[model samples]
Each structure stands twice: as structure tokens, then as C-alpha cells.
Target: MITWMQRHKKWLVITIWISTIAFVGAGFVGWGSYDYGKSSGAVAVVGDRKISVEEYQREYSSLYGQYARAYGNQFNQEMAKKIGLPEAAVNLAIQKNLILSYADDLGLTVTDEDIAKELVKMPAFIKDGKFDKELYIRVLTQNGTTAVAYEKSLKRDLLLQKVESLFDINPSSNEVNNLSKLLFAQDDLSIQILDPKSIKIDYDDTILRDYWNINKIKYMSTNSYELAISKLPFVTVSPTEDELKEHYSKFKTDYKKEDGKIKSFEEAKDDMIKVLSIKATKKDALKKYLALKKDEMKFDATTVIFEDKLPFSAENINEIKTATVGDVLKPFEGTDGFSIVKLIKKIDPKPLAFAMAKDMVKADYLDIKRSEKINNIAKEAMKDFKGEHLGFVSRTSIDKIKGLNPNEAYGFLNKLFMSKEKEGRIDLGEKVVLYKINSSKLGTDTTTQEKSVKDILLRLQKEELMTSLIKNLENRYEVTSSLDNKE
Candidate 1:
């Protein structure tokens, strides 16, 4: 990509060429870094309860750990920012307190047995398929907690779970069947992926320049940046044997031996040590990031021009492009550690000269021409479109569309079902898919009507209802956040 960009540097309104931020890294090597602060004394007050410093740290860690698990090595600070994970944690903290406050209003309470049942079911507390109280206390003690404190935290978690369950009433059979019909109804489809290569255009310098002039706004120079960076190198923190065992006990299901049974602590020790190292690095990275943000530390500067690709992810590049000069972004992961980045300069996009823009203009011209041609063909098309034979597909036939991706197929199916027309053309940027519905029938395939699909739809139905319930709950309570410590 750099070779291609360098070859066409004259016409480059900087093409988007780099990655977005993710876990802590400086030279772009690690999963990512987080930007949460240390829990100072007391934090936010919601209803009768205060979001204690410990609770604040725990919530942030829980959310961060979940993202790290889900994305694995690909997870980074940029992805976290994109997902608004930190904000989600704050909002979740607020929501939990709101629910607790409302639960109080409704006389909802959690008993000691409820806490016991939940704790006993935890894998960390179970031994030989039974709840072992001695093992439970041991794990807690090793992790620096007593049973009393653990039980108190468990009680709050259980109460939140119980309260949320009340909002998820079971969906009716009729509701499930309606969704099943949408997903299972079979349709005979004919598809044609219109290719840009098929549309030919004889071009001259004059013609190309004219096209560029007509669509000047469409062509621009690449947006670039100059930045100051502070890298927090990954420090290998060797966790104690007890720490590894505690981690294994807490999340034993994550480690699997060859036979698929949970790995013994000894077998999982090395991997668990690496996990602990990554976590320790994240906290250190956050501290480094805060120091940089407060101007307590600084780093030498570097240029991130259009041609300097692969140094940052595409997501982080876009973030830099969108940000103004003087903005300090949270630390993104490096090859060895986390980087606290400050944008020193932003070179805004400018129009590309005709010499530089000729190739791009020609490409865009061909694509637009192809789309127009295909659309016209689609208007006259009443029968078959010669491409791939997609036999029969349901509205949920995500995997069946041969020429398009699952997301493309989903969008097309939704459009196909929504339209009253027998045929239509859908543009998918590089190509166009002209689809014709030859025949249709009510949902009949028992094979497609999977129980799992129904359950997913049922969950979807409940979530739709729950979204509104959450909004109503938010209005019922006044949530004050001290998470950011802003007056």
C-alpha cells in the first residue's frame, strides 16, 4: 500500500492508510492500553449508597477484562474508545445504583441464602462438582479478600441480576413465531454482481482533468499528523504462584487442557503469568498516560505522514484525522508497550492536483458508470441475471449469498423483503448486486427453524422491551457520577 501511495503521491489527498488505537503500544505491538484513574477515596453517590473507590476500580477492571477477553490480542485502546467501554462502565455503574434505588422503592431484597447460592455456583468455589466452603475461603484469602467482603460484593451483583431478570419477561409463542417467519420464509433469488472491469472508458489528459474539475471535492490530499509520544514499555511482572492459582481459580473455565477439561493450576501457570503481566502493564500504562496528560512528562516528536502506514491501525489513523491540533489521545498499544500520544499538528486535507488525481478520477468514473449501466439493466431486467445460482434463500440466509459478504447479504435480504418490487439493483461500492425474486413461499423448512434461532429472537424481543425500561428507570432516579471527579 505504501509503494502504491508513494507512486501516486502527486495526486494523494492522503488516502486513509493507518490503524486506530487499541491496547497500550508505542510501535504498535501489544493488545492495547486503558486510561482509567486510580480510585482515590470515595466516589459518586447514588441513592443511599456511595460508589466506593474499590467498586469504581472493580467495575472498570471488569469491563476492561471483558473487552480484553473478547478481542484477545486484537483489543486496543482505540477499540475501547470506539466501543465507549469506559463510558459504558460509568453508565453501568449509574444504572446499577438506579436499579438498586428503585428496588429499594419496590421492597426488593436479597437474602443471605441468595448470596450463598450464587457464590457456591462460582467455579472458583467449586471442587469435585460440589461447593467447597473451605476452598472458597482459601481462594478469597489468597486474592486478598475475606468471605465477609466477598459475600457483600456478591450480594450486590446478585441483586442487580435478580432486578434485571424482572424486566425480561418471557416472549409469547406468537411473537417467536412471527420472528421465525421472517427468518425462515424461503425465496428464490437470481443475483448478478456487476463488475467495474466490464465498464470500459477511453481516457485522455483533457477528459481526465475535466472529470477531476467537475468532482474536485471528491478528491483530496491525505490528512497527516505530527505527534509527541510517551511509551510505557511492558514490564514483565512475575506474579507469585499463589496469584496464578488465584487467577486460575477465579476464571478456570478460560484455560482448557488437551482433553478439554479445565487445566490444573500447574499446567496453566505460564499462560496465567503472561495474563497477569499484561494486566499489570495496563495499570502502569494508565499511570504513565495520566502523567503525560497532566504535562508531568513528555516525549520527543515524530511525523505521521500519509506514506507512513502500518505504524498505527486504521482506526487510530482516522481518530488522528478527526482530532484537532493539541489534542492528546489516550495511550495506544506499542510493539513493546503503551504510548501516550499528543497531536502536535494536523495537516488538513487539500485538493489533489490533476496529475495526482487522474488515476483516482478514472477509477471513480468507471465505477459510477458501471453502477449507472447496471441500474439501467436492472430497470429492464424482468428475468434471469447470469451470475451464481443461489438456489433458495430465506431472509436470514446470511451465508448463502455467493457474491456478497454476510453483512451485504443481510442488508439485501432486508431490502428484498421490504420492497414491493419483484426485482431491484443494490450497489455495494465496488460492485452491484441485481437481484430478482422468482418465487416465494411461507416458512416451511423445519431445518431452518432452529431452536437456537428462536431463542436468539426471543432474547432480542426482550432486549427491545428492556431498552425502554432502562430509559424509564433512568428518569425515575437522579444519578450523580463522581467517576470523573468533575465538580
Candidate 2:
């Protein structure tokens, strides 16, 4: 099955970075301030606009709390700090502000009715088939949301979604079909792999001594110290009761509602009417487009015999049979969207006979047989290996294991680590050659205390490398933070 990311690669890449920051607490930070009248302190200031400190703290707390719930005991303050949770929250705030600003600039507006309709779709706010005001209030209150504030946020979100949809243009059918084929095409290759163990490595004690001496600095021990760290207090102004009341009053219009059972006709009547209208319009549009296409092709559908029932109207079936090049069918509602399908060509579906499918089955069988053969070859190659030192090593430490292929090191790490000390070779099926471990250590030496220092340095180096790579990629992309730009 194709993943959501695979289906929407461009959008996935754009949105995933922001999502990652919200979840993993790692990414960009921007200078910005949020202002909500008299109760505001600079959370961050992008340009002239201020993001309130309270708002920043609220967003951070919610995000981090969610991460803790998902990760459970693994979530710790140290991990949060390491992943730059504060920075992530700031970046998310900037992104949100930017998107909202863009929507405002474009004069995009979402009506109160639009928000209400969207709210009905939220499972938490719904009971049976109707929107449940009590459940809605309860959930929002539990999440520290005031009715007015939550609605404003929801409105902003809806506006952003509208703007995003405006940019959601569909590719031409030819383009979509070409892309689909590229994505779904399968390749069959007859591959032969040579086991690395088949290559001999000459090991001499003198050579080991010489190599160890020249690279002794790389294996040195250093003094180590363990220390405990604690967080220091940072000052922040607290909101008074009067201030909270004032803030609530200013935004209260967003939350005003009447109590009692809502008649669907009264609450969602407009929404239902709009939906029905759109459906009717689409049906009419399709019928008109199909009639035009049928006239162009001058073809009759009476000759074509469909073995199975088609999920289309009689007019739609005629349209498909008569569709010619360059004619566009009206959009028909599908699971994802209103699909405007162009009949490229109608190829008759035929059931594969036994003889027709025989070659395909034979090919699949041979592929499996080849994989098994590769595994057997690897086992036979390592039958006589013996060494004083053995055991599992990290994939990155392939150099430490003699007569091993660095390229295939990752495949063997788990097997080598899990292997019990034995005389014979360990066989990993399907071209993966395994190594036997005679002895093992945690890559640590208690006697010298030097191994710990070396390990720490190595870990730090790898982390630094990863950080640099991420920075380079981020720099290459034009990452604009609304938190910094919004006035």
C-alpha cells in the first residue's frame, strides 16, 4: 500500500518539518512577540506584531504534554531540552502566524456557519449524529480553552485550510497517469551477490601491533567525571484575576451560544443546503459534458458488453464509450475529491488463462529460489572461520571485524549481536552473510576508564555531523518565519 507521504510527496515535505518540531521538539526558532491587549508580554516579536508570552507558553505546554503522552516514561525534561522544545514551539507559532497572515492578505474569509459546520465534523464535539455542546465545552475546558479563544483559533485554522485548498490544483489526467505508472512500476532483476567473507584478509600479529601503535591516539583513555544538573528559575509575570476577566470579555463574542437541543435544520440548515446544491450542480455539469463528448465521438454504447455493473449513470456509460481525445468529463464525486476523469482509452478487461499467467508464476518462484540459493552460498563460504575475538558490533564498527563487507555491515549487526558463541558460521537468509562471535564486550573498559571518553566523543561527533546536515538542508530551502515577518 502507498503511504500518505508517498501519495503527496510535495505537501508531505513542506508540512512534515513543522509537524516534526511540534512532536520531536526540534527545528527553527524565530524572534517574535504576541500581543493580546493589556495582558501581553513579548513571547516573541516578528516585526511589529507581538506574540504573547502566555500564548507561547500555552502552545509549548500543550505540545510537550502531547509528546509525553505518546512517549510515556521515555519523555523527560532532559530529552525536551536536548530536542530544543522551546525553539520548536516558537517556530510553530511563527508558521501559524505566517499562514494566517497570508490568508488575511488574500481576503480569504470563513463564515461563522463554516466554522460551525467544521466543528460538527470533530468527533470530540459530536454525539450520535449531532454536535454536542456539552461535550464540546467539556473537552475544550479540559484542554484549557475558553470558548471564545477556541473559536478564534478554529476560525483561523479554517481560513488557512481554505487558502491551502485554493492552491490544491489537480494535475492533468495524462500527468497523473504518467506519475502513477512511474510510482507503481515493478522491476525484476537477476542479481548475483558475492559474499565478502570469500575475500581473504591476512592477519599478522606484527601488523596488528604496528597498526595499533600508529593509531593509539584514536584508542586512548581519558579522565571522566559525572555531574548532576538542575534547572534554574526564570522570571515571568503572572496574570491577575482582573486581567483574565478583561481578556475573556474582549474575546467573549467568539464563545456566545444559546443552551438547549439544536434543531439540525436551524444549526446546520445552510450547510446541508449548500452540500445538496453542490451535488446537484456536479450531476448536471457531468451530464452536459458527457452529452458533448458523445456527439464528438459519434459512437454507440450498444455494442460494448460490460461483464460487471459499472457505478455510473446510463448517460455516463455512453459518455465513456464515446469519449474522444481532448474532451474533459465533468467532475464526479469520489472518496477524495470531485474527479474529472478523461477516458484515455477503454481496454477490455480479460481474465488471465492458465497459460498466460504461467510465466509470471514461474518468475516469482525463481526469484524466491534465487534468494534461498544466495543464503546457502553465504553459509558454505564461512564454514571454517575461527577467531579468538567474536561477538556483535555496531554496523558503524565494521572495520573492527576482519573479513567483513562494510556495505553489508548493517544487515549483520542484529544477527552478530544476537549470535551465541559457537564453532560454526551463523547463516542469515537471502544473501546476508553472518559472523560468529567468540567473545564480546560493551566496547567499554572499566580498568582504564578511557573507553568511556572515546565512546562519548564518538557519539558527540555523530550528533554534530547530523546537526550540520540538517542545518545545511534548512539553509538550502527558503524558510520564512511569519513570527519574524508579521507586523
Residue-level lDDT for 91 in candidate 1 = 63
Model 1: CA > 4 A from native: 1-43, 141-146, 165-168, 172-175, 188-191, 204-206, 216-218, 222-349, 382-392, 396-411, 445-450, 483-487
TM value for model 2: 0.39
Single out the weakest 10-residue window by summed lDDT for candidate 1. 13-22
lDDT of 2 by residue, 407-464 (tens): 4544455444444443344444434443444443333223343344344444445445
Q: Each prediction's Cα lDDT score?
A: 0.65, 0.46
Error of 2 at 308 (Å): 69
Question: Which candidate leads in TM-score?
Answer: 1
Instruction: Please give each candidate's TM-score.
Output: 0.64, 0.39
Candidate 1 lDDT, tens digit per residue, 1-487?
3344235432322111111111211111112233334545455677677776565545555555554554566655555655555555556666667767777887889898787766666676679999998887776544445677566666676666666667655656676677676667777887877666676667677877888899999888876667787677777887777877778879876665422245678888887877777778889888877877788876755656652452666666667777778888876776677767788887667898888888899888776777677767666663545555677787778888876788877887887777787777776666667877788877765445657666787666665665666678777766677646642
